[model samples]
Target: METKKCTSRQSHFAKKRYILYDVNPLEGFNLRRDVYVRIATFLKRLNAEDKQYQWILVLPPWGPLYHWQSNHIGSQIQLKWGMFFDIESLRKYIPVMEMHEFISDYPVNNGKTTIDIIYQLRNDKNMYETGIFKEKNMIVSCSNGPVSYKIIHDQQYTGFFWGYSNISSYDLQCLIFHGTILNLKNNFNPNLYRSIMFDHMEIPLHYTYGSTEYWEARRSMRYNSILYNIAYNFTSKYINLMEHMDLICDLKNNQGKNLSQKPPQTPVTHGFDLTVNGIAFIVNFLDHFTETYLVIIDAHTKWPKVLNLKKIMEAYGLLEKFKCLLARYDSPIHVVTDGGPQLSSASSLSIEASSSCV
Candidate 1:
């Protein structure tokens, strides 16, 4: 099980490393999400225990799922992570990078990025047949393993790689693993390989299945704002209309008895509408400084307040500014925003944000 060490030029002084992974191609979307929680917990522990290196998780792309039966949407392969989940919200739990970003940042040669090694995970057949299991992470021979990967040329192994043809690995090894996710850290050699991939990540179980960290990771996986808007729009357009129609029919049958003497309640406090400028301004070293404005509105009064900033802020800074804005009126119970990255990340602190509701 010897793998030739492939070191990066910056490995001499680099303190950052990437962990890329994938589930079995047959695994469904829900199971893939569970694997993510396990990986997030593992990465968190890796960063805490190993102070010398910072570990970042590279998210696998989605598409061509066996369950996705719709034929009109065309090919769903190679879809980015942001299209389904809130990427910024994911970062609140663990550092994550999209596949495209990883490909761009990773060193490439001849239009291909070679992974240092690929650990092909397989089940322990003996334990499954005998109904007896023991924790293990043993390197087995790949000669009789699954034939998902093959050596293409120049000793580079090629496989699905999430449908990307440009990605390959220098070596492949079969691992018979039966343990928690954290146990896989024993396979890492940060000094030799800056990047590694796990082909069958779904085999490992979570370190703590129902602990606080597990729940935190699960909550951070919020659906994209677009999905929320679609659901809200459907409810507003169809469900509300059906309710109104039922009310009209009731009034026709019951007459004035069904009429209410009081009006609907209007939220006076704890209602906010947030938005950022549509465009950004970049200025030279002169008096005209770069600026972006954040606008906050009172949902009940339709009143607006503008906050100026030298530049667009990230999640942490945006959260601070949002807290100051909320203080002027009171603690926010519900807030609405357009679901942009910064606003969505900030609102995720206490409430979920969308165009219609928070």
Candidate 2:
């Protein structure tokens, strides 16, 4: 009887500890968000690309002053920041709050202090930057550029929703969106949730985490390592990547709410039609390399002609290819393309050929 009583008591205490850990295991440590903000702010002082992340400068074991001066300042940091890393590495690099006691073993109060670096992240500036993406030569710069611009709106909601010291605005928003999705999954009202998410949150149209557009965008971002390197959300970005857009966001138009409209009728033709499709450069086979393919098929005859081009079928390239085909084969009675810039511009080419040749 005594053994059973003791075991029950131990089990009760164990459950309480688990609950405490879930709430927060290290809450007693008194870690201030000010420390994180200061560290990130100081990194930005470097005046380099996407200052949120900068290479930690270290002393060269064998280098003398003259050798260091011979190389470009950024060369030391080159290929060091890397495409993938975490916040822990950053914390070890620098701390916003300095705990080390001043050396000289005496409180002289003469030389520079770490206090000069503690900027308190004033004016609601984000302690960490994330999400914004860029491309080409300025990709990293472009991704980090929007961090400051988003601070005002994103931080306001993040603080209002869940103002834990360690949580940054970008993360808080991800959680909010994540929870909203879970709530909907559990049968929460779609209309009300969308009202808050769209009108209130102002997340751009078709950018919702579960939306088709969001997944398409994410797939594009992931396939290109350059852009993926700058993305901040990896886990939460995939929270609902497979789910379809929630019906709530498919806001219906009420402009014709009380009016009746007739269904449109179309006339079917039995004429020859040309389906011209150009596969744009889906992915560069190698860095700085890409190709475009053009396909022309007869809708009725079922005959297909494929052209493999060495160049990305740009507007001019499409015009040249389409002209060559028309010059050789029967003039396509009508042409249709999936909005390829090259193929669309062929409209003029078609008119010219009609007037001069066919």
Q: Pick the candidate with the highest TM-score.
A: 1
Q: Would you give me the overall lDDT of model 1?
A: 0.65
**Candidate 2 C-alpha lDDT tens digits along 1-358:** 3443233223322211100001111221112122222223323232243233222322101212222454654442212122222222233333211112111211222231111000011111221254433211111232322232124342222221111222112111111122221121222122211111111111111224444333222221111223222221341244432132111001111121211111123111211111111111111111134655555542222234566666745766656665665554423322322223223222343423333232
Query: Model 1: per-residue lDDT, tens digit, 1-358?
Result: 1222344522647777889998877889999999999999889888888999889899999977889999897878988889988787788778899999999988787788888888999989999899999998999989876757999858789988889999988778899999898789888888777888887899998887888678667766766656645644554455632221110100100111221111123221212111110011111111135766665432212234466655746775555654554333233322222222222222343432333212
**Candidate 1 structure, TM-score to reference:** 0.67
Give candidate 2 misplaced runs (Cα > 4 Å): 1-290, 330-332, 340-358
Which portions of model 1 miss their true places by more than 4 Å? 1-5, 240-331, 335-358
| Global lDDT scores for all candidate models | 0.65, 0.24
TM-score of each model, in listed order: 0.67, 0.17
